[model samples]
Target: MSAEGEQYGSSEEEDMYSDDGQEMEEDEQGEAPAAQAQPVLGPKEWVGLASMPAATQQALLNALGKLRGRNVNEMTVIFIGKQGVGKSSTVNTLLNERVAPSSPFQPENVRPLLAGRMAAGFTLNVLDTPGLLEGDSVSARGLMALRAALNGRKVDAFVFTDRLDTWRVDNADRAIFTALAENFGAELWERTILGFSHAQTTPTDGKPYEQFVAARVEQYRAAVRSTLGMKNLALPYVLIENGSRCKTNGDGEKVVNDKPWVTDMVSTMVDVASVGEGYEYDHSKAGKKLDPNNKHKIWILPLFLIQVFVLRPLLIGQIKRDVKKAESKAKGKK
Candidate 1:
């Protein structure tokens, strides 16, 4: 998608998909189950039906019928991440217009914001929730609220957001991903894509921007692959900067993201739309407590602090006392 320019938190900007907001639907027993697809007619075709003539709609369906293994109607994408990780910003970039509130301080109280009807034939809907963090109840509740709102509708894809500059995925990110797998079964990774934003920072003063980005991109890829044990599965991710303001130069490229990041983002959504099943929210698996009991979910900074304040000082004092005792014994023998 091409953009004329980019702005943040503009009073003029509005949430075009605000009407898509929905509350969690419960069954007779007050429980929401995993998603089970009813049928698909191809989202792009469905969205374009209203705008096209009756004859055009018939021709499009006829052509779609001839094409085999291309039955994707609508892609339901849910963005789960930290408060200011640019989830709304990424959605705005994808729509090529403001469909979300970009103000860092603004409250996105609406859940599951849907895009305006598309004549382009692609059906894409986005749902965003409050941030999730480990060892934090408020954060966990935010994530659960999002899952609950889906009301057992099958999800086409789940976009896990992180930054290009950061070298690590925090404990909360890991826990949430784990919960997804538990809810949807282990194949969840098959349909998952890691989105890396803030790519404008890749090119530095003296560094070769292309090579620098390539190296960092590989690192992020490796991290995800190792965690999922999908050594052979082609690592899925999007590299782009959606957080910064932009001005389109004479060329179509934005000041922040010059690459066709929006296109790739949407295409990636289409690519993985069929990888997994619609999932149910399992509270038992979500919001894992961050402590030593869960060794796999520990943060590196906490481990380092333990060494500096707990382990390292103890070792140093022990060594000093041993040296003094040895010297006294030698002097007495002499």
Candidate 2:
């Protein structure tokens, strides 16, 4: 038996590379490549997934249901920032539930949850990570966890939650951004959306979103554009207030009760998820027909795995390590 066959058994190995010959033929003939086959969600796979708690499974299923027909297999969003930036609250708002614990003085609260979803099909799983602060020591375990969680996962988008009310460009933010670029590649900024949460705290008298962007065009727009090298790096920021949604007037006016910022944030997420080409499914047939471009099929499977297995765990580990380190330092001081 071949070396791979010895590891996975001959049958499994055969199944894994079953399409190798066909792929080679298409490549040699200069024919358009066939759509990659979907990973069979078999009994073993389901059982492995079922190891997660029932609640997690249900949450994942709910998220999946919301994404059905979008041709998305999985999506993961991680919230990173210093404590008190409302990362937990932002996650709760996104999931429409208080799944993540939040507190005022508690700089670090809960370990990352598989916040939104945990299953097969299309789902958005969120990770609420510990705050990365300037001059703070980050644990290797935390870094490992983050790396593992992100491995093989297709990040639809990332939200960098910063408190603009106390906006100071900090080393922690820079460090985290640098680490993300190193691990995930520089293109991550293109897939990232900066969420300046606690925007309601910003005095309404200062300036509107567009005006603010215009005023600090260099700091806000140009800096990010030049650093990320993406012309469209000007991300939208939202003002979020607990217990109330911002509303807007119909005539393109900001209503007193309008949460246009919140709406914009949500809309941006939808837009990101909607990007990349989509496949047309022909329901008339016994099985759905995949796109000839094979883009969707090729990307979705690995994306799903990364979100479920890698990103969530890594974020959680990072949070836990940070929390423990904070506790240790506190004890030492006492």
Candidate 3:
């Protein structure tokens, strides 16, 4: 597969594309309308939601669930991704505010930022984490802070991010997935959903956008399955198009996200929490070195330190530096 676009096999059923083909047929000028403010669910409305139609009810439920405090219960979710993949931007969008720091120049290395907002019967506790680097594992001390934030609540879902236009899975990506599997166990994959940044826009690749997206999704799915050595498994996914790129679609419309993507994101998290019966926060495995006695390999200690302490930090610094330089060059030329 090409470095720019990771290719994967096959296709599947309906996704976000099927619903907006007609709307996308027209190119809108300027930014898409900002998301409309969500209404708070009063006790009466909360009680009334049950009687509304399925779609409307779910939509409202998702909205109220995100609002910070309204006597609602909470579901905690951790956002995981390599740095600069729009994790912070997505988090800001979710909170309808700039709660998370984000910029195009570089990834934020800040510690995990946790906050809880409650409405009706839903409480959403979002933990925005530092980007995952190969061999860069969480410290036991960091996990302690995370567990303390939970107040004993289970982490319902682990949201992993990628660009919608990314078409290939690299070796580094595979390693990150393997680390996650080992830390959370093979079961965490069950509660995972591939959250795509820039969900509304697609890059031109000599083919239709939808076709490209389908292929990319498959490639990502295959990568995860292969990492886990499982041939028959599909990861849950959601797409949120949040970017500055203005592009043309076959529909002749400039790609713009009006808010459905965010709605879907919240709803999906709720579903995972409900399904998993709540994923508890467990960091006992943090800072774990490779087993020295594993039949899989011998002499893993020095290798572990090199991976975690030496190589990982160097890679992280170089990436951020490159991103900043690229952004600076683009600005100067413009």
Instruction: Estimate every model's Cα lDDT from 0 to 1.
Output: 0.54, 0.48, 0.56
Residue pairs with clashing backbones, model 1: 42-73, 43-73, 44-121, 44-122
Instruction: Sort every candidate by TM-score, greatest first.
Output: 3, 1, 2
Best-matching candidate per lDDT:
3
TM-score, candidate number 3? 0.59
1-334 per-residue lDDT for model 3 (tens digits): 0111111111122110111000101013211111221212211112223333455445646554544343336566778878778887776656544456676664463345554544455656666666665254433322222223333346778788988867678877887677666655666677788998866654676767667777888889999998889776657788776554534344322233433565577778766766636665354543342221133455588789899999999999999999999999999999
TM-score of each: 0.59, 0.51, 0.59
Better of 1 and 2 by TM-score: 1
- Candidate 1 off by > 4 Å: 1-19, 23-71, 108-112, 134-138, 203-206, 247-258, 274-334
Number of clashing pairs per prediction, in order: 4, 13, 15
Model 3 worst lDDT run, 10 consecutive residues: 16-25
Model 2 weakest 10-residue run by lDDT: 1-10
Tell me model 3's lDDT, rounded to 2 decimals.
0.56
Stretch of 10 with least lDDT, candidate 1: 8-17
lDDT of 1 by residue, 1-334 (tens): 2332222111112211122432333334333333422222222212324333344344434433322246554556777666677787887665555556667688654334444333344455666655655353224345444545444456667777777777565555555555545443555566667787776674554668667666766776675566666676464777657755543434344444455565456667666764555444443443443221344556778988999999999999999999999999999999
